[model samples]
Target: MVDTATNRVALVTGGSGGIGRVVSERLARDGMAVAVHYAGNEAGADEVVGGIASAGGRAMTVGGDVADERAMAEAFDAVEQGFGGVDVVVHTAGRMVLGPLTDFDLDDLDGMIRTNIRGTFVVDQLAARRVREGGAIVNFSSSVVKLAMPTYAPYAATKGAVDAVGLILARELRGRDITVNAVAPGPTATPLFLDGKDEETIGHLSKMAPLERLGTPDDVAEAVAFLAGPARWVNGQVVYANGGIV
Candidate 1:
């Protein structure tokens, strides 16, 4: 068990990306020492870590494929060594390949399954074992899982599995004093979400939310901050950050 008095630590996978980057910084601002993990974008991860440091917060950078057990094990080891032990794990690493089911490439589907499904399992399994008592594990799902949007079948399938993992793991950790939950964000204005879209589609999605705007990375990050930091009772559930898109 980690000493409750020390600074809490967090390992955020995909800390280089849109939503993940914001989460890494937010956790740092909340006073946890953060390990910003990136699979490919080392520069982005560096920027996040540097910004945190600039803000007088504690942070470091680690890198690995979320699907690789050995790589992730090393990532965890580094964070444990750097900050005593991990208290929160907010897994935001994922892949998104949007297209209609009829024309979807089998290989694309396989890739999403690899990163989104298997990657989630690998990370969660480790968190279940390594996270300290009173720790939290937060995974990323998607609003598409609830929206049932077109061209999102493959992606949503992966997140549905994430939802399953969070719920079951919360039960599996029955008395461990840990909470597990998934955050499902709708139509966030991230590079990943905006990459191939046209203006019309973007406008439609923005309006789908009663807020009449797209969700920002910060918007979703607030939800994550609540789950990872002080929401001890919010376990085994999917928290929707979709701005009332339903």
Candidate 2:
């Protein structure tokens, strides 16, 4: 009972904000029906869905904690019921906490692991099953995994795990014609980057890269689009969209 005219469908977890928002909207504009997945930001997700629909693209918002299996299942069901099976899945939902290893709070570690690692596992498992053949899976890793920044040990650990999981997933899906890849972004100009930092600190961090500026959500989205669309031969690789901040 789905609309066969739109063969491309996408589920963008955390699509309510920042890089997720931009990426989801970009995919919709590219002619994919997008499911804007959000944890607790129903209004934000709705805004993204509304924007896409207003622009003559098909989109809908579904709310759930990405780390929760039951919640994620419901979200996926909404997508399947609303727009048929998924063709692409972009996992942009993750938790980022900063602390040195010595000072790493177990609670923070637990939360981040659940959201970043467990959440990705659940989403990827379902997406890999639901997405049609020749579809693409994009998971979010972090530049911190390569940069090894101080106070980001715990956060980086989670992303490092993401990198490994994504690569192995690519191999597991062999012959299915599905590609699994990870996008590791450096300090980008997203709300997550601005949360607790002042202007001067942010500027310094931005200049740390050779590009002399922080990345934009659109910049990351472009990389995701390439992997999702035409980079069929690219599989099991972490495309660092960090503007050379490695």
For model 2, state the Cα shift of residue 223 in Å. 0.6
Model 2 agreement with the true structure over 60-84: per-residue lDDT tens digits: 9888988888899999899999997
Q: Please give the CA lDDT of all the candidate structures.
A: 0.93, 0.90
Counting clashing residue pairs in each candidate, in order, gives 0, 0
**Which is the leading candidate under lDDT?**
1
In candidate 1, stretches whose alpha carbon ends up further than 4 angstroms from where it belongs are: 1-6
- TM-score of each candidate structure, all chains considered together: 0.97, 0.96
Give the C-alpha lDDT of model 1: 0.93
- Cα-lDDT of candidate 2: 0.90
* Candidate 1 lDDT tens digits, 1-246: 443323789999999879999999888888889999999999999999999999999999999999999999999999999888899999999998888999999999999999999999999999999999999999999989988988899999999999998899999999899999999999899987898889999999889988899999999999999999878889999999999988
